[model samples]
Target: MAVTLQSLETKGLPPVNDWHPDFCGDIDMRICSDGHWEYMGSPIGRESMVRLFSTVLRHDDDGHFYLVTPVEKVRIRVDDAPFIAVSVEQISHQHVFTTNVGDKVILNPQHPLRLSDEGAGVPYILVRDRLEARIHRNVYYELVNRAELRMLDGQEQLCITSGDHYYSLGMILEQD
Candidate 1:
């Protein structure tokens, strides 16, 4: 399917959530763990193109990522999550995150944050419709600075609150 910049300009992001397309086989595209988008073994350098492609990205129940358009769906490899949380801000007691693709997600029950056991428990937040953005190291540090010690299940944990929900950053490891 052809997705033109002019079409995107007129309609904003495509209704990918509503459009279900058939898989068109895998493409030589990958979202690297370090938050770089690559196509055909080279980096996709244009931010506009990346942002445009990101709008049509989707995660299917088959445990794969795909770029979906109304007429076609093509799989892509993702080393980690599809997007990276580049920065975060606390606005009106809400933890707001900005992804590399320019998507802003408010951390709440609908867009909750979770810690991955991989590599010192990296944090990730849901951007939209089950698509998550791995929290950048510096942004994770900012969250740690804002976290407070809280008791959960009889264990001391560092947690950040967004609205009425408390999400754990991680458990405190006691000194040996």
Candidate 2:
């Protein structure tokens, strides 16, 4: 079924956060690393369905991801973060990120960008309600171009400023 902003607004998304549903066992659904959703090992081709499922996705305290509803909670496999930050826009003093699942997040203290070098310095930004979105390579490059060096905790660091807050990308080491 086609989903529109109007339709979503009228029906509204289920409050998965407030629901403490029982576990309904694992489902053959997976969200690929590239932000594609799959079911029974085949890609879910409908954007609307993906969007709908995204609304119910949650990360439990045990670090497991689940698709939740009022009565059922189904485990789903996520290779990485469930959402991907596909694009970014700078407006005034804030950098806004647009996720593949259609979430708009403003970079601030609450939604900070984090860089981890586990696999060549992957970048992620908090999107909503404790969920994060992996920053796409092209968008990450754009952010790097705008990065500036600043002194942090008595050490030089690469950082970015948004919403009047300075977010440190990571510490910079001086060569001998």
Candidate 3:
């Protein structure tokens, strides 16, 4: 049967943070590193279905991602981050990020940006709770283009300012 928007829940995002549902075992669902959602080793081609599922997704303290509801919680595999920061826009002193799942996050103290050692020192921004969205290479470059070289900790660093916080993109290596 084809997945339809009407077939999925029409209600707004549930209070997943408040729900204490029982484990419903693992599901063959996977969010690939490229930010594609898959089910049973196949891609979930429905954008609406993916969006609905994204709202209910949660990353628990146990270091596992889950599709949660008031009644049950099912584990899912995430190769990297559950969301990807596909684009970014700079607004005055703040930068607004748009994720693949349509989450708009402002880079600030609450939604701070942090560098990841994996994938050649890629960056990630906190979307909600403990979940983060990996910054796409193109978007990351946009940030770098707007970044300023500052002396931090006695080293030249490329940093970006968002709100009142200064986030370092990375260090600038000296030429030999």
| Residue 43, model 1: Cα distance from true site in angstroms | 0.8
Residue 101, model 2: Cα distance from true site in angstroms: 0.8
Q: For candidate 1, what is the TM-score?
A: 0.90
Better of 1 and 3 by lDDT: 1
List candidate 1 segments past 4 Å from native.
Answer: 1-12
Q: Is candidate 2 or candidate 3 better by TM-score?
A: 3
Alpha carbon lDDT at 159, candidate 3: 97
Q: Each model's TM-score, in the order given?
A: 0.90, 0.88, 0.90
Write down the worst ten-residue block by lDDT for model 3: 1-10
lDDT of 2 by residue, 1-176 (tens): 22432232244556778999899999999999999999999999999999999999999898989999888999999999999999987776678888998987778776789877685668899876678899999998888789999997888988888867887767787789
lDDT values for all models: 0.88, 0.85, 0.87
Ranking by lDDT: 1, 3, 2
Best by TM-score: 1
- Give candidate 2's whole-model lDDT: 0.85
Off by over 4 Å in 3: 1-12
Spell out the clash pairs found in candidate 1.
none
